[model samples]
Target chain A: MNLYRAHVLICGGAGCLSSGCKAVLDKFNTELKAHNLQDEINVVETGCIGTCDLGPVMVVYPEGIFYQKVAPEDVTEIIEEHLIKGRYVTRLLYERPASGEQIPFYNEINFFRKQQRIALRNVGLINPEVIEEYIAQDGYLALGKVLSTYTPEQVIQVLKDSGLRGRGGAGFPTGLKWEFTKNAPGDQKYVICNADEGDPGAFMDRSVLEGDPHSVIEAMTIAGYAVGANQGYIYVRAEYPLAVQRLEDAIKKAHEFGMLGENIFGTGFSFDLEIRVGAGAFVCGEETALLASIEGKRGEPRPKPPFPASQGLWGKPTLINNVETFANIPVIINRGADWFKQIGTEKSKGTKVFALAGKVNNTGLVEVPMGTTLREVIFELGGGIPNHKRFKAAQTGGPSGGCLTEKDLDQPMDYESLVAAGSMMGSGGLIVMDEDNCMVDVARFFLEFTQDESCGKCTPCRVGTKRMLEILTKITQGKGEEKDLELLEELATSIKATALCGLGQSAPNPVLSTIRNFRDEYLAHIREKRCPAKVCRALLQYSISSELCKGCGLCARNCPENAISGEPKKPYTIDQEKCIKCGNCLDKCPFNAITLK
Target chain B: MAKANCPLPTSNLSEILDKYKQSPGSLLEILREAQAINGYLSREVLQLIAEELGIPESKVYGVATFYSLFKTTPTGQYIIRICESAPCHIRGAQDVLATIEKTLGIKPGETTPDGKFSLEFTSCLGLCGVAPAMMINDQVFGNLTGDRVREIINSF
Candidate 1:
């Protein structure tokens, strides 16, 4: 193989792709060819570099210089100055939001330096479309090791020792799940990779599939070997078209490489894999519901005493694991359980990938150890909340998650601790909130989601969520009564106990947790008829400050409801009765007169 | 590829139906592919899929309505899905949505008179890093402001 002096790794993950990384990629190639550096310098489109706020992000190899928001226009200066002339492009380097201090190296950047990538080891490093790149990164070696040497029981023992739990919400022991399926009485057992990631703020699974599809495939194939199963299926979300495509390509290529098809390593243990695309349903994230969807039915959850281990798809014993869970299997096989155990906390023995988004300055994917403090993840790694805003809260899990305030920042992020703090590690979506965000509105938004996505098969999840949403909605609308709070608490408690599945069981968490943390905000909305964050429109009343209003008639002309009226060079007053709260007058006013109280 | 009114050609639908006819538990995939050709799964198209798969029409329709991605009614050429999830909500998705609605002279679940655009609220497109995001067809646009929303709508 020919060696290249430089490697340009441009982020091609969903975040950067949406941010127009493709144009910059094309420009890099064009400039590289123009300068006759195409052969000498390789331009590789890698996965998410984890700083999504500075998207279209790139990292130059050998030097490790990290650049953000890279445009096609910036490619020339980079190629001409950095690649050819050996001088760094200072303007493109990542600058700290608070201090404006530039950090040039990728390893030195706070966002990535703090992360301990295990499942995500190959994500941003290898080209997912090519199998060679994955193989070079020790991809199929674990499968080769497991097939060549380790017995089925031995493989299961290694996984059990590794203490890797499922990353798909519930954090069940993966080894136990695999062992149960292996021990279950069935002639045709199946291993499933649940890629139906429905959590709203989380995209870690999608990133894993898109960036390193082979990792999931190789891991699933290893799982099939360990669990004594000959067939496997990956049920992925249809919304993730890129992930599905990459998985499809990876599976076909794995076949050609003799890593996936029948009689692997001449061991006579035949295994095959297929991909099932899910029609959009949030309930499908549940294992039972996901199994039903794969069987070409309406995705709905059933009670799980007769779990998938004994009775699963088509009355067969099936071992199902999440995409992130499967991605960890190969690593455990390659490096012994001891190496994996050294990284994380006692109970949660691995790094968790978080989709750090919302008000944070550095919004993207970050994988940190299990015991990392919320404060470290937010303030140090995430670059804190943007625009000098005080950190209000961080909504962990998803719609089912609770809000973590300043008090919870110092707490270690683990499965037990998060649940004790009124939250769960539900797929690792950490959405930060600041002063401008309303807790009541945030609760209301999640309720609207759970209510809409509820399968309606169960009365409690379907109906209970709707009622809870109604009360929350009433509170936001400034029509809430004092009795509404007691009613919301009672309903939330019952919904947690009586709901059919995980979706309904955790549906009321955001509301309950928010009320527990920010009851003052809720009380202000209900009793004072004011939104503390000025977020709820119904509670917000628009008024014009007489001192600031110049009376140019701009506010009057722009108001669709004709709410503002005044004469020239005089103070303008907004008619509250006529105002629809559309904020047209606020946007149109030249002077800073309009305010939403 | 007919507009909201006309019946779609069953020839392409039959090909999609026939390809997945033998695959067990492919009703959703078949319906999804059928919609790709017809734009929206018409009653006749649903009947065709049901008949081809030997499943009841009600079963096919049940599966179709169960998932949000399948559209029974005809949408405009472009389906603009604005994510209303909490992540996007805190990032000013409301304003971006309002701008789109005002620009198109329609609300969510409504299409333009010329069949150029249809607005809908999606839970999350997983583009939260660049919050206040929307997906038109498969392309995602993020970090959206009101002026950017207008510019995107006009471009479409």
Candidate 2:
């Protein structure tokens, strides 16, 4: 082994990869070699550090100095000044958005200060491709302890006592599910990791799989040992190519190190793993649909009474847990159940990872304790809404969740509390909205998504969601009536009651929750044919403000339809007949003359 | 001379099939690789895959058509996928989409006349923080603006 003076950890997560982190890494290599410090310094490409807005980020080890948005040109400075001279680069560090104070260390940043990293413990800290780094962090110790010391019953009991529930949305107890599969009459069984993360704004599972691939693999092997299974499958979406590559590499490395494959650790127990990449289907996130897709079928959900525990994945007893849920298992085994039980609320133990996006200052992945309030997440951790926009609403749970208004900001962000506030914590996609966002349009956007991705297997989900979307579409287009609102309510309630799976049953959540909270916005759209947020283009009538219009002919020249008729040095007029509501004239008007009524 | 004589390649097809021939869930994997080799999945290629995998042609075609990733029709040199989900939409994805459409003279789900780029709006690329994001082939572009869209397409 080689000892190094300092290690440079660059984030190679998907967000950073797109932001040109690869170029930065290459620059570091060249600069370090040029400085003749290549042998003394080590560079490691790690997974996401959760502060996605600050991409192409790097951290210098030993001092643990954090750097943000370091481009290729800045790598020379970082390598020469920080790496060689032993001085921190003040310009590159992440300054607090509000306070404007530069925080040098990763843990001191407000975004990471409140986070309790159970699943993401090794994400930014270790190189996922290197097994030795994982081993150094005590990876696979849980599996080693389980294989040598405890039986299947005792392992399941510890999980049960730890009160770990599924982070995949429904909050099912992980231990009870394992026990059911273990007790099921079967000589052959299987364990599966649900990495088919279909939520649009959510990337928790993708981050975990990309950053700490071995954590999930180690936990899956432990799950196999507990559930009396010898084979495991990780079903991941094909869109995440980087995640797939890391997982495949991790599995290969594990087998070479005697961590995976048959007769591991000389305990005479055998287990193996394989990867199944899913074709794009939102419904495949459902366990039944996922198993069906893996079996080379059309990826549709089957009715549950013969649950996955009883008859799953080829009609045999199988244990399935989300990627985040499985990532918690190894830690629970290493640290006692009592230790794991101490971190979170009474009902919801451990931390929940959320992909916070939209309008917020610090938009990224955050893992907070289950009972953390929405105010703390959005305001404190998230650095509040960007551009000083007043908070309008926060959309949680993707299409299956509702929007919470300002009043619900103080509500505890857990499974039960979120549900009580008219939104279920469906995979932790918390999208913040500002004052300029149209609530009705927000609801319509989610409805359109659910309606398009309905799978068409069940009647209520396929047809009923379509009906709700049609009503929402009409309202946004300024063609709505008062009776349409009542009709929408009726259809949403019926769809909720009659839909087949969780996808169908929660299809009306976004619509229902918007109506429950932002009913005034809906009424204004229907009654007055006005969009207060100026988002509904169809409802907007473009006109030139006579007071401010200079009639420079820019609007007329830019307009594809020749909507504006005007002369230079005089006020202009817009022809409603020719106006297309394309917002071209609005963007062209320099004096802020064009107004939409 | 021998390569020029053969219009289509069948060399990697056999190797890919041999690797995944035993697995029951190899149908999707085979279709993906076959599509990659040929750029798009043709009837002849599908037939060759079915014959190599020892499965019926109808079943192979069904699996290909079932997946959104598999392309039956020929695509352009570059596929530009813009995320139109709620997060991106709220962050002005429509403006970016309009700009791309105007710049390319092609709408979503249509290829340009030059066969250089095809524009399509997908659900979410999972890079919501840097909203109004797009992907050309496999490379994701985030925090996109109208000016950046034209520059990005010109580079491709």
Candidate 3:
């Protein structure tokens, strides 16, 4: 390969692609050709560069100049000034949101500084569409080594020594799950990759699949070797089209390269994988439900302990792992168990990927070491809460997780630590909430999600979560009695205890965690009939401030309800009865005349 | 590469089993190909696959229904998947959903009377920032407003 003078790698992940990274890359290529520097300068499209909010991000390697929010038009200047003249585009460089300092290197940004990428190790570094790129980066090496070198027992033993647990919510030991399937009495066994991530604010699984499809393929192959399974299925949601497309492409290339089909790498271990598209069901994230879906049944949960490992798909022992968990297998195999063990805390060894979203400044995918504090992820890496809003709470683990307030900011991010902080490491979805967010509304939101996603197989999850949501809705609307809160707790506990699958078991977490940490907010909503955050629509009353309302008809004209009855150029009085409280008038009012009481 | 052509809706279970008896893990592949031809995995297909693979129909049915991707019923002309995933939910997807329901006058997971649209809620469409998003047919519309949703629906 001829060495180019420079490589301009642009982020081609979903975030940047939507933000016009493809146009930016095309323009860069055109400009490079026009400038006759095509031979010298090469433009490449890589996976996610993590700082998704500041996309169409580009990194000029060798110099490693980090550019944010680049447009197609900016490509000319970049080629003219940076590429041709060898002068840095200072204006295009990423400026610190707080200090306004120029950030030169991509890693120097707070978003990337704290993250320790392991599952996302190859993301943003390689072209996901190509197999050789994945191969060159030690992609299928682990599967090759495991099939050729290690016995099924030895492979499981190595995984056990590595201390690798499932990153897919449950935190069960990956090695133990493999062992169960391996030891089970069955002539035919199966391996499955659970890519049907149903969590809100979670994209870690999708990112791994989109950025490194081969990793999952290799991991599943290794899993097949360990569990003595000849076949595997990847149950990915059909919503993830890009990830699905990339995975299909990767699998085809793998088969063509003789990596996936019979006698792989010249070994006798034969394994192959096929993609199973999920038809938009959240309950399918549960292992049993997932297996049921793969078997062409309605996506619903079943009782475990005849767990998937003992009698999974078609009554055959099956070992199932999520995308992120599979991404870690090759790394754990390449680097010895002890080396992988040293990165994280004692129990939670190895890094975890989080889809950092919500009120944070830099919203994207982040992978941090297990012991890293929540404060670091929020402040240093997340670039603090946006719009100078005071940090109120952070919701982790999606619907299955809980809320953590300021008091728990210092808590480490490992599976146990998050659980200890009234949250679980449920698929690593970290949604930051500012002071303006209503705790009551937040709880109701999660309850509604769980209620909608419940497979309706078990009574507790099917009925219990709905009752809890009803109480929450009543409370948010200022129609709740004091006993409703107590009833909520009682119902939550019952549902948690009686639920059949993990979905039902963890559904009460958000409600339980919110009540535990923000009990006062609930009391205010129930007793004072007031939403502290002023978010509850029914609790809010739109009032025209006599001091500020200049009788500007803007408020009256814009009101969808025609509640502002005051005459133009005179003092305005908002009729409380007719006010719908949509906030349109408040937003349109120039003098800040309208207030929500 | 020779495409293995099995009998359409195989009648005899034992004969089907004998044909694919040597191939390991032939159950899912044979069933999928069979379903692809038949539009839906019928009981006859299940029984045929089970007998050919020396397994029971109950076992085949169990595997067929284990995954969400497989469908036993026939689908409509266009599948309109509204992402009820977390990000979309936060962006007032519930409101968008209400608008869709009122406009189409059909709840989610239901096909319209004309069979033009089959509405369903998916987990995530991978377009979070453009929240409150949905995919009508195969085209994805992000940062959805009720009006935009209506426009997309009308177009379909």
Chain A TM-scores, per candidate, are: 0.99, 0.99, 0.98
> Model 2: per-residue lDDT, tens digit, B1-156?
011112457787778888888888767787777677756787888898888777798988877876677777766778888999988899999989989998999998888886778888776788887787888878888888999888888887
Question: Which residue pairs does candidate 2 place in steric collision?
Answer: none
* Model 2, span A430-508: residue lDDT tens: 9999999999999999989988888898999998998889999999999999999899999989999999999999988
| Overall local distance difference test of candidate 3 | 0.82
Write one digit per residue (lDDT tens) for candidate 1, span A44-92. Answer: 9887777777889999988999988898999999999999898999999
> Could you estimate the TM-score for every candidate?
0.98, 0.97, 0.87
Candidate 1 lDDT over B1-156, as tens digits, reads 346655687788888877988878888888888888757888888887887788899998999999999999899988899988888889999899988988899999999999978899886788899998988888888889999989888887
Q: Which candidate model has the greater lDDT, 1 or 3?
A: 1
Best by DockQ: 1
TM-score of 3: 0.87
Off by over 4 Å in 2: B1-8, B48-58
- Models sorted by TM-score, best on top: 1, 2, 3
Task: Tell the DockQ for candidate 1.
Answer: 0.81
Please say which candidate is ahead in TM-score: 1 or 3.
1
